[model samples]
Target: MTRSRTAGGGGPVALTPSERAERGKAARSSVRRSEQARFEPGPDRPDPVAILLEQEAARVPELVPIRRGRMLESPFRFYRGAAAVMAHDLGTAPHTGLEVQLCGDAHLLNFGLFASPERSLVFDVNDFDETHPGPFEWDVKRLAASLAAAGRDNGFDAAERTAVVLDAVSAYRLRMQGFSGMRVLDVWYARDDSADLRAMAAQGGGAMLARADKVFAKARSRDHLRAFSKLTHRVGGRLRIAPDPPLVVPLTELLDGGGPTDLDTGLRRLVDTYAQSLAPELRALVQRFRVVDMARKVVGVGSVGTRCWIFLLLGRDDSDPLLLQAKEAGPSVLAPYTAPSAYANQGQRVVAGQRLMQAAGDIFLGWERLTGLDGRERDFYVRQLLDWKGSATTEGMAPQGMRLLARVCGRSLARAHARSGDPIAIASYLGSADTFDRAIADFAESYADQNERDFAALADAARTGRVTTAEG
Candidate 1:
């Protein structure tokens, strides 16, 4: 695709596929693709403990204990919340300098099933709290390492973990190669439909496929109504959020002379602010619903200490409810190493990045800036709370099941990268050889070792009372 260069008064020539591929191959002179295949903690390695403490300094004090509690469960759990630590390490490692909008914390658990705008279930990256443009290899390394850590936690043999990571990398290589040859629009529109996945599972016919069936079934049941029924109750002839300490604290409880009247006024203001971020049509649809209650909800492992609120809105009647989550957005973990975001608000940066990377996104997705009751201003992105969301559990997955999931995750990541980066360059760099794949597997094993040491140090800190942790 050639384009006119108005400033130069001439048309800029577009490079052929062969030229693009050659350009990628030439990049090997600066940093060999195989060079990134290993992991080592050189002399200047940053202290992982110090990194964790620095991140903790900015989070809610009360929720820190809960975050610590969840992270302390296992090495894999600790890895999930240590994206900053990994970012620091990636900065010290070899890099290809091919930038793509990365899922900065692209761990195994981060990829999951969620509903598309069309209400069809799809598989994609469901989290974007730490997204930024960075070296493409960074995401691949993070994912491979996560597989190893999770495998170790699940008592899978080292051989099993190695095989899984290799399969994932190979899948990514092949998919990118395929994407490189496709029309740009075709790559942009590709998505993993849940119906297609189910059909594949049915054809495969194994214990692994059976497990996938269960995950899909669970996702189908987790819609807005399910969340509303489970989290709210009738109080004095009106629906109010149930008070669950720490995990689910109603906003009204945070104020003096707390009552429904005070809560409604404050929450309505927040709703108005959030509505301004949405498109005019979405705003109109949102305005039709009346805000009933809001609650501080403790969410994911990495996000526990961050402020997250769940809003319940009544539409047509008491039975008609819509749930939305307004999640706080901070600077991405990758920000310290990569270029800063152009968007002034971090929430807007998140929303923009998610839209650019995903094939589809939540219709209600938007960003807002609001001053909290504490007089602190925070950026938050809002979306539907539960839209057929489900994630695969590693605990009971068979070896075959893990491998199949690995391939799906790999393909999803490739598609995401192709949408935002040069598919030809990435595919050319990977080539048809298994060199990159083997190298990533090697790095995954080595990094998994490093993660265990970091996890052990954190566990010791908790046991010695250096850090406080509350049991879940």
Candidate 2:
């Protein structure tokens, strides 16, 4: 397949619009869109359980069982935590090799409502732990497969599941085509408005509309104040984080000889390093707050075992609390297959990819490298713990609502790709027909079947004591 941009040999020569379009069309000769539409397990697929265990080697030993238990919940849950498994399989799949910064784990649940820097709710990809540059189809496949898994989890019949997957692929294809004809700045500026999503949900009638309204309302309340009320309490006249065993515990409680002094000192150093990563203006804003209490917060299914810490800071007083999350960042699951990142730190890779793909990002987003209390150095990206963030649970969505969510996610993915990759080339590759769309639907159903088997394998592991699990 032809590369989207000129290959670097000496100096680069900019290709004309026609040259770019022609190159995109030529890609179809080597990588036919129809060929990529199916999924079949290769004969030499890696053992899913083995791959998962390898990942656990670098994670918190105590939390590894928790991550496993979360994955054991259902097929959909398994899919969410098994990004490395899918990356291994995607390597064997046919592709055009059109690269884009992927939300490597672009599952439906990863798309959510969060306030922009302007305080307006915008729907976009929220997680970047697995962000990397790779074949654009990998992200699409992940999203489509997620719909199928989630559809089954929600008890939708096969027909309803098929419809949802198809709708999402069609939205992605059509949106890419629209982006192809737009100005570069226009494509960069494209964003999913929460109001527009609400209007779309309204078409599903009163019940669906009410659900959407409730979700949005809940998202609006996920600010620092809301977090403070639930996570903090007055301890000897000082506001300190409340203990929530297993999931939310003060850092001092987890470490050997760990106490307030040690916790505060380490956190203060982390915040100082993180502030230097930010833009000078933002660094100035951060300097106003002093670190108060930091805690180990077990987050999502995929992130439960990682080193995730939430640092509490007060801007002026206890009334002006700010919470930020310092999440460990590692090599992208796709990194093994794709080229190595140009950035030195994996956290910087995540930050750079997020900046390139999102229309806008958290004002507090930054990265740092530090040695933990265990004395092992790791990279981490930091951002606001809750900036009016809201996400819809798969358990509650109706088929119609799932379709709407799929469309928005598809459109958001397109927007993200258009910003960093060649939209014209991708759109030209997708074409105006249903060939690519139908093919993804086929792949999604097939992969969904594979996912069930993988899920069953993990369940067996848990039952046989091959893997440890705890109540999620």
Candidate 3:
């Protein structure tokens, strides 16, 4: 690939518009668009269960089962948690040289509604834990495959599933072409508006439009106040996040022999280090609050085993609260397949990638490196725990609603890539025809079939006592 280190590289020489477009057209010679449809997992593929066990070595011992069990929940769930396996498989796959700031795990459910710094709701890619630079098609393939898996999970027939995948790929191709002609700043400022999303849903039919409305309404009510009500309770006149065992445990509870006083002090120090990465104004805003409680929070299928903590702070009184998540950052799943990150800190890698790809990001978005209670240094990226955050419920979605969401997510991914990658070249590569679109649909269906077999393998492993799963 010409550009490989987190998508924003152009060397010392800036290519002219014509040259950029030419560069894209030339990529077709390296790997034809139709060839992208191929997904032949060779006989030497790594054992999927072995990959999961290796990842578990660094995770909390007791929580490993929860992560494994969550992955075994369904074929779709298995796909969500198996990014490392896909990375290994894609590492061996052919690709175009074009690179972009990738949302390394760009599943459909990862796209969501969240309030921007302007406090206006917008739709965009919300997960960046595995964000890295790689072939633009890697992200596209992941999204398409997720759609195929969801379609299968929802029991849609093959014809309907292909149609859903096509809608998404077409939206991405057409949007990239539109982006290719825009001014640099215009491309950077492109965002997904709720009104535009509503209109797209309307094209899907009345039921899809109604579902869109429901999602928007639910997103609006998911601010910090809602988090406080749902996650906290009054404990001896102090608001504290309620404990839920392996799922959610207060910091003082998790750390052996550490009282709240000592725990708060350490958490306060971590917050101070985290604030230094933010802009001065935001740092000052955060300094106004005192840390009240910190909790170990297990979140998401792929992210369950990571060291994720949520900090509760009150601005003025118990009535004013802000929850911020400090999620441990590690090497991107794409790292082995692509170039190593230019940034030394994994947290900084995530923060930088998110800033480059999103139209707008959380005001509190930043990164830090500090020694954990285990006495080993680790990187963490921090952001508001909830700011009108909402993800699509992939299960039980109607085919029409799924198709509409596919379009929405495709357009969102194209917008993200256009900001950090060469839009002109990518648009040229995709071209005006639907050849690449159909090819990706083929690849998606094929990969989804592979995913079912992998899921079955994991189930077989569980039955044979090779892996332990969480109990109900």
Best by lDDT, which number?
A: 3
Give the runs in model 1 whose Cα sits over 4 Å from its true position: 1-14, 199-204, 256-267
Candidate 1 structure quality by residue, lDDT tens digits, 1-472: 5221233556576777887787678777767877867677987887787898899887889999999899999999999989989999997666776778998889989999999989898998878998899988899999999999988988889889998999889989999999999999999999998876776566558765676778888998999999989999998889998988889988878664455553356456777778888889999999989888888899989888988889999999998899999888999988988887888788998998889889989999998887653457778889999989998888766677787778888988999999998889888888899999998999999999999999999999888998999865
Candidate 2: list runs displaced more than 4 Å: 1-9, 256-264
Better of 1 and 2 by lDDT: 2
Candidate 3 shows a clash count of 0
What number of backbone clashes does candidate 1 have, counting pairs of residues 3 or more apart or in separate chains? 0
Error of 3 at 208 (Å): 2.5
Q: Which stretches in model 3 have alpha-carbon errors above 4 Å?
A: 1-11, 256-265
Q: Against the unseen true structure, what C-alpha lDDT does each candidate score?
A: 0.86, 0.87, 0.89
Q: Please, what are the lDDT tens digits per residue for candidate 2 over residues 370-431?
A: 87645678898999988888987889678988998898899889988888888888888899
For candidate 1, the lDDT comes to 0.86
- Which should have the higher lDDT, number 2 or number 3? 3
Q: In terms of TM-score, how similar is model 1 to the real structure?
A: 0.95
Pairs that collide in candidate 2 are: none
TM-score for predicted model 2 compared with the true structure = 0.96
